[model samples]
Target: MATAYVDYFPLYIQTGIEAGLLDPELATFDLARLAAAIKPERDLDFAFLGLQTLYDRYLLHIDKTRFELPQAFFLRVAMGISLKEENREERALEFYELLSSFRFMSSTPTLFNSGTTRPQLSSCFLTTVDDDLSGIFAGIRNNALLAKYSGGLGNDWTPVRGIGAKIRGTNGESQGVVPFLKIANDTAVAVNQGGKRKGAVCAYLETWHMDIEEFLDLRKNTGDERRRTHDMNTANWVPDLFLQRVEAGGDWTLFSPDEVPDLHDLYGAAFATAYESYERAADRGEIRVFRRVKAVDLWRRMLTVLFETGHPWITFKDACNLRSPQQHDGVVHSSNLCTEITLNTTVDETAVCNLGSVNLVAHLTGTGLTAAGLDGELLRDTVKTAVRMLDNVIDVNFYTTPESERANQRHRPVGLGLMGFADALFALRIPYSSDAAVAFADSSMEQISYHAIEASSDLAAERGRYQTYDGSLWSQGILPIDSLELLRQARNGDLTVDTGKELDWDVLRVKVLRDGMRNSNVLAIAPTATISNICGVSQSIEPIYRNLFVKSNMSGEFTVANPYLVADLKARGLWDAVMVSDLKYHDGILSQIDRVPADLRELYATAFEMDPMWLIKAASRRQKWLDQAQSLNLYMSAPSGKALDELYRSAWRYGLKTTYYLRSQSATHVEKSTLQGTDGRLNAVPVAAAPVAATPTPAPVASPITTSAVPATPPAPAPEVPMDDSLLDAPAVCLIDDPDCEACQ
Candidate 1:
């Protein structure tokens, strides 16, 4: 493997440059030295799914044959990102080590275009659509161009007037935001992200809009075909006032932006005041094209629509704006496609964010939690370098639109997050639903937050602060933790999130104030759908979906087994054909297996098997450290309206800025025909047994196991049934088909 890479690297570089795929400057590198640094053995680290994904879409290929192997691919990306550095070769090597060793990984776009001629390294972009026709078309056109270069998008549509609003120039009623959204959806479909991936865009509408009900129905299959935006993602830009009204069971009024234009920019108390005043105007018959409805009724409808069709994700407007570090600069109208990026978007300035993640599994010091389990020094060094690489992307990136270029240059935001949280937990022997897990979430994020802030401050000391740094929260010496006070004040002391700190944040605060900050925003947690696969780790901040399942993707199907569970079983002499059959019989759920140890069952409990409130609690801990937001997905095996109400309310009370997909247990079961030697046979499962409901509280850990046993002989082969291809097509734990899922990495 080593010899193959060493000999072919120079030739690959030559072919790439000749084909105009690679940067011309790459030809000047010491090809021999770079090739010699390639550690082909790291290729062994890849699971089948990871390697297949790389080969299918990531690796640089010529004539449909991959010329760049895994290590070479990492080196190529590192070299592309480090091309402008003073010691470009050294920096490239350092970055290569991080990538190949699975210590850090950049977003999909950065990996795709990093070493290429057009390095469109930014992952996500946000643009606010103006109410006017020209401005709306401009925003749509910008979407096409941005998506053409493989960037995910979020468009704030609150400024556009709702249906029944008067159009003064034409002296007619407007058809509403839905029709324009239809055109935007078509544009995204047409672009298709340069044919590499689906062109994805999310449309956000404020809850107070008169067309709010119609916006909520965009993804429903029952709606009029012409009125629905089936191709585009939708999110409700919910204000705290709406929730307050819902809780109060009071009436809520809607308005057209033309009549209430400033509502798009207002948030928190100002929004509440203006909204209430508008309600009174509607009651007094002073406002036109306004409607009134019970807030509770509307809230129930929102949840019902959400359960029926997974659209119009619930995202809080006030939590996003109130806790924003750039609150002094502008208001955050909405989050990006993944709901992880909360930034100010305007007609003149489109928001752009560069993203990357550190592999948490690489920073651990032992297999189980110790007093000093996480290597603080190693994480600090990794974050420092990762931040530098992300910062370099802004200078070297190929911007498709001038608006994106403008916003990126002025604020220079970078999201340095993490992956492999579940894997790290497994290594630490901590159950996902336990208090120890929540505590680790807090400490780990606190450490990442501390280092990311300090890293930006270090960059500011050397390279000067961002152009708009003076008016930001850093200028006021308020970090993400300290900014919670702003949210508390905005919510009138109703907020209920923990603000405990383990690190000496004041020292970092003093450093930030003294040196200013290189980036306006430093942290966000994107759903690392594909990159986590490349690293062979669990998805970003997600619980284990299953112990064993076949994952399907663009690369094809591959079996994913929990290696940690397998190792523990093998140690206890429980690994056998019977165990595989048992897993298949229960659809990879270990809790039902009588032969498996109770402690192991708790440790390996799948996502749906555990109470989802634990996910919320863990996210709340992480949210306090994240400056932007997190792409948090809640999983429920059995869902109810009441449970959803309590869960989302907990999210808001915990000060969560945004939420992502709400995954429910699929009715389909994995086929058991693929087991070795068993043919079509499956281990006997109790016919009357039913799945346990995931209660909203943590359950105590099971007692440790002393002994376990498996049957001496496997069950005989049984009659085969016709195969269902749908089972093969079902999404794996990590790779949901949502277009925005992996776009932000």
Candidate 2:
């Protein structure tokens, strides 16, 4: 075997010089000493798949030649962050340690393109346009510019007047929002994220718009291709009045924005009053044209399209506006891409959020609620730490556009969210639907929301408050918990907590008023699709999809199991050929297994077993504390339109701002095996039945019988190779011993 000891110090210095990431004079200082500072052994930590992903996409390569090493990558990121800091080297080293230890990481765009020329690091962008000819096309150009630089765009199209109202200036009937949306869609396709990924945009419309029916069909395959925005995402910015209509079975009126100018600006009770007044105006024949449909009927069609094509996610305008710290700034029109960020977007100000997710599984300690359960104290501490990390990211992140930089710097907004929530619950053996689990969800998120605010307040004490923090909720000493006081006042006519739990509202409120906060918005729950997988835990706050399933990565397909389940079954003498067959028969559910106790069954119900309502309820509980929104996913085993309607309506009633991904399982069932074989590949015999009244026994310390009984041993460690700097920023390496980590996907 050949050994290669390529010194990384000179390479780092050279790249820093070439990229202007460091001063050229620093390149000559103690090259050998810096080389000694690099830990070569960290190179051994890379799993084969992680290495492959890095080689394929992450590592900086010039004409198929790799120049930087793993340590070099970390150094580049650290250098990028500490470029303006006074103690640049010390800060750089501290950041390097954090990244190397996997304590925290920047967003994908940041990791991919930072420290390089034309660095475009923001992940999401929001834009709004007026209905006029130039204004509408100007929005399209803005989308192209942002997308060209690898930023996700969310455009608010509410100001665009609906189809066929009237244009007095032209003396002609208008073509409406749909025609403009189609042009916006094509621009998204044309400027495809600099070929890094797909050009992504989300078009948001107010529900009162006359062209909403056409907007809903933009992603439908049968629609006229010219009118469809198949490449872009669509969302309905629904107000509370629409929800009330759906709840009351009342008629919904749609009209052009020209006729109803203030509809988009008003919300909650005021919006309802204005909408009713508009309906009366239409009834009096004061408006040009109008159509009335059952609110529930419109909601059902929205859900049906969501389930069918997975576009136009549901976003609540009332909830967003009511809870926003920037509510005084303007009515929050829409959430950004992925529906996790709720910020004020306008024609001039394009809302931008710098996002980061905490690894919840990393904070788990055995002393608390075990690995699979909720630990409020640990969670609180972790959230505080995460808030600091995300706040730091805002200062460190490279902005692609001037608007995003300005917006981010003014608000200093940071989204501190979690990955591995479901995995954490699984480790604690708490069922997703149980009251204990729901209470834990509420308490845990409340702590995160509370401490995150406190952490930001502490940061403000040192660095000063965000530019727009003065008139915000935090300035009024109203934290998320204190906001709940307002809700309590609204509901019961008093700012009192009749509930038994003695929440520490007074302390948080006092701190906020005294210290203020560094950031306007501190917390949000984003859908951890790619990041969660890298963390090797359940994606955000969703139930386990399956006990055993295939995760297809670039390297190849690999079978992953629920680690907690594997451990539990092994201890109970229940993990065997027969158990595997039973689990396979039920599509990874252990609920129907006669031997598995009811408690364990409840604790480990798959996504199919837990009611979709439970997911919404849990989200609602968490939403109360979250200032922005949650990337909530509702899962149904065999979904009907009626079931989805109920789930969405309940979400709306509970004051959820945004809902992402309506994941419904098909009615298709796996075919049962009927093949006969003595070797038991297909026809394994069941063991003798245990006593019906058998008491639950504690799991064994370890299984004695090994390879003789089982056909396969545990997988071996992947091979190592010479360190490649290009692969350092790839996804985190997966530890083979921890199967629960796979749940993050």
Candidate 3:
């Protein structure tokens, strides 16, 4: 550490230069002065996982050795983002301060390739396929190119027509969207970037599409091998009319795009009208390849597939398109891999979004219920900087396809999301199910929404507004919160949609109308399961998974104890090694422990402990402020058909644009957590069936990440590599920053 920073100051640059890891322009900076700006002490704030994540994947490496320390890595990223600024050094310093302080971090792509030769900085891409062989193949090729760069992708499969549809070229019936989706799913698996992680592409099919039934079955375990797409994620793009039909228990009909192509171009009233017209055509035998079923039956099948296989996520088509600020430009045919992005995709343009998340815990002024709270000024400052960094990504990002580049430049969309909501709530000592939690969610997101718009508008003042700013909802002075009225009007009093706003929307609305906005869309909430682990916080807008249970991911299993829970317990003289043992035995749920206080138990409720309604209520609140969407996972202990049905209906009624995964809990026994038995060996504790929410399998590790800012201990030794290429092969490395769910934060 001394040799890299203090002794030579600019040694990292020299080392990087020799290894050919440093960008040529990056080499021209007065790196010695920049090296001097590194705050080595700030490294101590990071828990071991945060530091380990940097060392293993983020730090620039030569061969197998990592020379970049935490502070220097932060500075390098800052320098990369600010390299084009007129006052590069000053701006870099500002970026460094924010990053080194643990206040904010860019998405994975930015961290990986920001200062490298190929800076493909955007996190994910969304594309739409036209109903043609050339266009479909082109969409698949674009998916490969983008996935070859970064993993997350969203493809709209609705326009590709359906089974028994006429084919002009072959004079045979079309095979429908499933066969094409299979190719896309296989492409994602085949084109993973340098084998870093399996590329993930979410194929979205509308509920109205005739192929929707098979699309829902793509993830089923018992499905025909040729039909199942186990590798790729799937989502149902349901419009409001379908939900209304389901609500009224009316008959629902599905049609192929080949026959009812106009339905693909409509939404809300226009969509309902076009859909009925298509149904009438089908009745008259004008439209072929159509199927009719009870709306509730189809809705039930959608839920059954979702709960059974956890794919084909439920996303509201009308809600997404209706709420989209860029609805003027095109329709939002699909959401991105994580179900957070809602950008428009057309035949000529593939929607793109650059993503970054604010570490919510870092923005809080202090820790614990009494000390920690959000300072309005500080949050605004952090969001302003984060928005700027995300916007900068647009210019710096390397696009893989012309369509992606075209869409990105025109709409200039960015997903400014957040992590550590659970952590922030823990600090405030709020129960996940409490009304207070909902209020906090509502207020915090409102603040983020306000400042993000303000920052975007401010950027537009300096730079010009996005190319498609005209005729957008923003041009009409309609903010996301105000757009609910549009939905109410579009639905014609069939639904009562409320903004549930605690903040003054009118004031923010006026500011937005006056200043114009730079970006088309903002404020999406990602799972942040990976990035949160790097920052040592809970996943985005999610309740704590466990207090002392092992979190197993690619890096291996980590025995994470909730620090805030510990602090609260310790304050009441309840926390100790015994308490830890008990928590481990009970699988980190406090309610099972008799000695724990009732209030603390409520505050420490895990995902399955609270009602799914609370999740919906809070998300609905957050959704009101967000212009995009959130990757919301709803948990159910012993999920039932009736329970699942009501939950989704409530979600639609609350106006949530998307729900990522329906994580059902299983009745399983808790295992002993590294506790010694009579033989002084770890024993599995045989206990009553404890409910466990389903999550991606956790891979526990034996080693712990060191947290000292200073080198109180030497850097951990690196694993050895074989000299012969064929002698030894390393296991495929998966990104550990997030849970299996896109590992985002």
Candidate 4:
């Protein structure tokens, strides 16, 4: 790391200059001052995972000799974003201070290629493909271009004709979206991001599409090789009418968009009426190539596919559009790769979101956290600066396609999210599943929403409202909380929400209504999987995966223990060799340990130990205020069809925009990470900073994970096992499948 100053820095600059990657002015910076500003001590802040994430993909490499250190990487991104400021040098220092100190972090692309030859600083790009063959191929080309850089792709396939539909140009029947999706999947694999990570894209199809059934099978292990798209992500763009049909036990009719074009553009009651009309028309033989099925049966199949193959994610189409501030610009066709992004995409315009996350761990008070709760003013300041950094990305970004650039400049949307929520909650000593945790979730997210809006309003004052802000929901002062009524209407009063406003919304609405807002949409809670690892905390809005486990990533497997749990244990003199053995033998949960306090056990329950509704309930509160969606994942120790039905129904009843994956305990995939082997068992190693023990963390049993299909594929009939209290004592880690699109996090 020290060589960044004496050796690696000048060589990198020389290489950058030779490749025309660095700004000409960068070569003239005072090296002496830069070296002085660099604090190598901050490097110690990185846990093994954070340092490895930086080393493998982020650190600048010359002939595979790692050079750019962590602090320097922050400064480089700061410099790149500040290039056009009047006092750019000083502004760079300011940005560097915010970043190096871990108060803020830009998205992966911004950190990776920021000051490089081809700087692509945006995280997500949403585009709609035209229904024609030329347009479809063009969309494929666009995906390649964007994925070649760093943008995760979301393509809306709703407009395309379904299987057996007549094609006017070719005088043949359409093969439907599945064949094209395979190509897109291959495109994602073929266009890896400089071999650092896989290029990720998600194809979205509306539930009414005739190809929807086949689309769900894209990720199955035993599918026709031509149909399986294991490399790409798939999501269902479901409308509220379908859920109502499932509830009412009505038949759902699938139609080709070619036969029923208007349904794709409609939502709410308009959609229901148009869809019923299409069903009647198909019954009268006015429409061709239609299939009818029991809505509940189809719903079961969707859940089956999701549970079996880990996708097609269930994302509500109407709720996303109904709640969208940018609904007037165009309908929200689909969410982005990780499912947190909700933006409009059309053939003429591509939606783009430049993302940054505030590290919530830094939001503690000056009076020490216990004395005073969360510091609201500091959170506002952090969010304001983060918004500025994200806005700067719109100008600094290298748009791969003209459509993306056009839409980005017009709407100027930015996603300002948060990470380390679990860490913050742990610091506050709130149990993961408690009512207090739910209340805290509501308050903290309300604070983020409160300040993020004010900060965006501040930007509007300085930079003027976004080009399309005049007729947006913000222009009418329709905040996200107010838009819940629209969703209630869409779901026909089935949705339940706590009708409470904690903040002074009346005053803020007036301010926003009078001044307008800068961004079209804000506040997306991404998976934050990789970045949370980089920050050495729990992933976005997630509980601890395990109190101790081995984390596998681009870096080699490293022993990871929840440092908060360790500190609490060490404080009570409960951390010892036997405690380590017990933790390893029982897979890092404290329920089986008799010596620990009951409250401590309750507070430190692993992801699988607590009921999942707690996670959803908490997310529902955040979703109430978030303009964009969240990458919410549902976990179950024992899953059954009935259980899935109730769980998803509750998710809709609570009005969540999207859910990522349905993780099951017995079916955990071990491809990415495992903690079972004797060589890899995590002992008392801290999650972040703690005094090292005289002896290293002990690796328990040496048994490796079973590499077989049994673990990967659960039985067809979802297990109906009751929640067993005894299973909490079992020696199994709560392994989560990392998103294929870890680059965005």
Candidate 5:
């Protein structure tokens, strides 16, 4: 394969250029040097899942030949992103080293089309819907075009008027945002995102919207089919005032956007004052259409719907806006599809963000994670190069809509996140549920945040500041750490975020204020669902889902075992056929394995085994350093309204800008099959013969998943069962399939 890649790469490029699949401006001699620079041996780095994913969706092919090898694929993406650099060859080589070495990777979109004929390298697009008929239809049209090029969509539907509102032009009542959302939902299903993936879109309605009740039912199976947007994701654009009202048991009023138009734009104390005045107007019979309900009732309903159908994910409007670096430019109506991106959207400009992630596992040195294990200098270099590559994506991209192009040029926002966080934790031997893990989350994010900001500032000195640099948070010398204060003030110090710092942020702040910033926002932690597979790492900051399980995806099922766990068990001479049987019997949990050491078991606890608060605590630490937000997914073994309420409220109190999903274990279990050997005694299956696992089983057998941070005592283990092929069919944990759209990878 390596020899074929080296010999046929030129022919592949030539054929691609002739077939209109590649850029025709290439010089043959330069391509020759790049092709030779490819180190085919690095292909060995790919795990089965990662390599299969690349082969299935990413590698450039002609007539299914798949002539482009792994090294060539990396070089192609590197060359594509660095086309505009002064020394293009040198820059491409730098990017190639970063990517091919598995130290950094561009998002899936960039990897898919970076050096192609039309490079649509952006991941997420945010658009604000207008109230008029033409504008609504136009927004739908924009969704089709953007999805055609594989961009995930986030539409702000807050501006559309609710049902029962007067429509003066037609002399009729407005049918509400739900009908239009139904149309948008169908559009996303129809597009299919360039035939590579499904068209993913999320509709965001403010908590104050009168249609909030109907919006919450969009994902329910028993809902009126026409009113339900079963294909679309929904989230509540919650303001701090609403949560405060819920806490105080105050009355919450819902109004149509047409009547309370300013509420869509106002946030923080301004929004609170305006909302109260509107309520007073309603009480005096001044406002046209308004409904009042107990705030606690509405809050409970929100949590109930979330637990039932998983729609309308809880997101904080005030926290997103208050912490936005582009606050001076515009309002952040909603987050992008995966809930990581928080950018400003307007009528003329659709927000665009190019994304990439650093491989946290790649930067670790030494056996145990001491201060000396982190290679800060190497990380700094990676950040600088990754930022430059992201910046170039804006200039070289093929925009699907005029609004997206406008936004990309003006703000030039980019998300630089990290993958392999869980893998890093495993390598360092840290338990995910421990305070040590939380501290690591804080410290690691602080370093990443510091370097990302400094890199953007350095870029500004070289490439000039972004067009909207002035009057922004960077111009005011307030970085992400400083922005937490703004959220604190907005919540009147009710916020519970730990404002800790480890880096010399003071020096970076001065440098940013002086040199400006190349992008409006940097450092958003996207889901990294697909890209992490390509890098053979854990997804962005997620805890280990299982120690062993089968992963099901488009390509088929593949068994994935934790290498770290296997190695540890092997070192202790406990990793034999019986141990494998024990693992499968317990459904990939180590806490119940008596033979495993307590420390190793603690280090390898699955996501559902730990209390959900551990996830929140670590996420809160990372959130403080992030400019935008992280795609936080909260897990609960048995979800209840109260548990859901406490978990989401803690997220808000901790100042999380947005959350992605509410994952819970189902009530059913995968039927256990019996395995017997020649002697009619039960025997363990070997790794080679492990069968595929079932999907969506109950949370592993143990104490039910908790919502509190206080650790609970481990549940007693069950008596040993006879091992058989049945054990091999254990439930696959974590993300077995692509949960989020690959656009944000």
Candidate 6:
């Protein structure tokens, strides 16, 4: 068969013209000429799986007919990014190169709706519902409108009266927040974004609310389906006081907002003091009714439901409020859909975030350095470029709802996140949980945060300060680094930094105060599921779930191994059938195998092998720098209620604004050989066995001593499992299968 090269630009123009979306006058630009500009050979770089993923989801289609090819998709995104540029064509081409070459990617919503007549370019939305009937329905209408425009919603339901609360207007008891949440849930289902994707919402409640327990159980499958909004997400807007109570093993008193007012507006020690006073009031019968439960017990139950149902994502009320650039404007009641965005959303305004991710792996120079071993200069440049790109996205994006537009324009919030962290770590041969690895995480993120703020400040010089920037911490010359003083205060029970290595915060703070900031909040770490796959990197900051597993991409199922792991083992002459069998026996853990060196074991520790505390700690360190929040997923093997309780409490103590997904391993591990019917045959013959000692319990590596300091020791190598094609090829879902799937996508 003869292969023919066809210019793809003309194809896109023709399709657009045929669909009546593109004007013939715009065709003055030669499609073939533009096509010549594209390197057709780049098309070959896409693996069958990557190509299929684009075809199935990324490509713009009209009724099963694809109008936008891969090249067209890149062009459209480029056009979207460069919509406001004076040198539009040049900027578009530059963006096209970055996108097509897989250097970076816009968020999925942008990919899905850009260049369309109605572009809903935002990723998340936050709204608040009023207590009155009309106001409540109005909130539902707002949710529907935002959802119709492809925005995820986070609703603050703390103001609504709880069950059995008095309704003055009706002169009767109220049905409380639960019934209203059910309506919100049904509405999310009813309006499904014109069938493009499920309508996503996260309902948030203050811990003081009486309906808190029921709210936490909404995601439980065993619960009354009517009371549950399994479709929507739930998060607890926890105050520091609650966490302190849990830590002190004190009692927690629950009260309706109607009875205990002003609790939502307080933070830190003030909030704790007020809460304790409220408990005393309730005990004295000053409050109508209340329930007292052991704080740890309540925390344990929260974890229990989370372990089973996967939600009520933990977000710190105090941290979110204290760090908010919009704090002077209003108290931020809750975060948006994915918990990465923390903005002030009220009855009048809905918070919006225009998000994009930098492909960290792309920054690695081709000097045979893996993504994990990215050159510092390359990483810094990528972050600087990405900060600029996200800033541009804020200006060029077309908002679907006025409230969202208003929120985004005033705050000018943008989330500059990362993808391929795991891949990068693998390339660097660094364990995700090691002190050295944590230092890298801290330094890299601090660099991004520092540069992102600097970039926004530069934009502020060009444009003007954000609408609400006047009274912000930025205006006070308080950089995110300066906020460390607050954290040190919280950590040490007083404001003092005993730790050495003074950050260059004073300088950055001075610079920020002088220049102002273009955006109110500049940095957030989102779970870049689809974008990561597009860049062929690991998802977000998560570790690899397995070295070898079956990833069902759009093309079909294929086995994907950690390329770095495979290459390293191949170099060691240990890539063989027996090693594969060991991996199977160990459930993808490599530490127990004696053949694997200590260095590799430390470097290649799977998510389960790495302690949950390490994940929380790393996120905490990064959180100190981030103005908004992070999509930090905590992984645990055989997780208990107590384990989860401690994990979340620790997160709260560390002042993390938000926590995203809580993924736990099932108790029973499915031996791959048993599933594939090869177990008996594989184990029938006894091979030469290394006398292996019992697996040692991995200790939590201490936090990095300094922001820029490197650890003294390199990560130990993970033990080698004898390789078997069958075991290595175990089947699992690829992240791109459903780009809109809530789990990974």
Give Cα distance to truth, residue 605, candidate 2, Å: 2.1
- TM-scores for candidates 1 onward, in order: 0.92, 0.82, 0.90, 0.90, 0.92, 0.85
Better TM-score candidate (2, 5): 5
Clashes of each: 1, 12, 14, 2, 1, 21
lDDT digits (tens) for residues 533-568 of candidate 3: 666677788887776666565565555667776656
What are the per-residue Cα lDDT tens digits for candidate 1 across 656-718?
999988777763356677654543233222112211110101222221211223223222211
Question: Per-residue alpha-carbon lDDT of model 6 for 1-745, expressed as tens digits?
Answer: 0122245566676677677654443354444545566655667556444566678776766677877767777777666666666666676676777777766677777776665555666788888777778878888888898888667788999988788888888789987789889999999989886466678788999887899999988876676788888778899898877766666768888888877777876777677778889988987888875788887767766666666667787887877887777778888899877788888887788888878776665665433332324455765655555566667777767676677778888888888877777765555555687665666667667767777888888878877788889988899887766666665564455221212223476677777888899888888888876566666677788788775555553345544445556556656776566676666677657788899877667777888777777777677677878888888877766565445555666666556788877765542342464433443213312223211111111222222232332345332222221222222121221122222323213
Number of clashes in model 2?
Answer: 12
Model 4 over residues 1-745: C-alpha lDDT tens digits?
5655545555566676675656665666655566567777777777767878889878877677765768778878887887666777676777887787777788888888777767799999898988898999999999999988878889998988999999887789998988999999999999987677889999999998999999988987775999889888899999988988887778999988988888887888888899998888888989878999988778878877777777888999888989999888788889999888999888989899988888887776533223135778888878888887888888878888999999999999999888888877676666667666766778788889888898898889888989999888898889988988888876667776665667899988998988888888878987777777676767888788787766677766666667777767776777765666677767777889899888678667878876777777888888999999988878887766666776777777788888877777753322223334444333335223453321112111111111121123221222222222332232222237464657567
TM-score, model 3 to reference: 0.90
lDDT of 3 at 270: 92
Of 5 and 6, the candidate ranking higher by TM-score? 5
- Tell how far residue 313 is off in model 4, in angstroms: 0.6
CA shift of 523, model 2, Å? 0.5
CA lDDT of every candidate: 0.83, 0.66, 0.75, 0.77, 0.81, 0.68
Off by over 4 Å in 2: 1-6, 16-55, 64-75, 367-385, 396-398, 485-503, 553-558, 572-587, 591-600, 666-745
- Give the higher-TM-score candidate: 4 or 6: 4
Judging by lDDT against the true structure, name the best candidate: 1
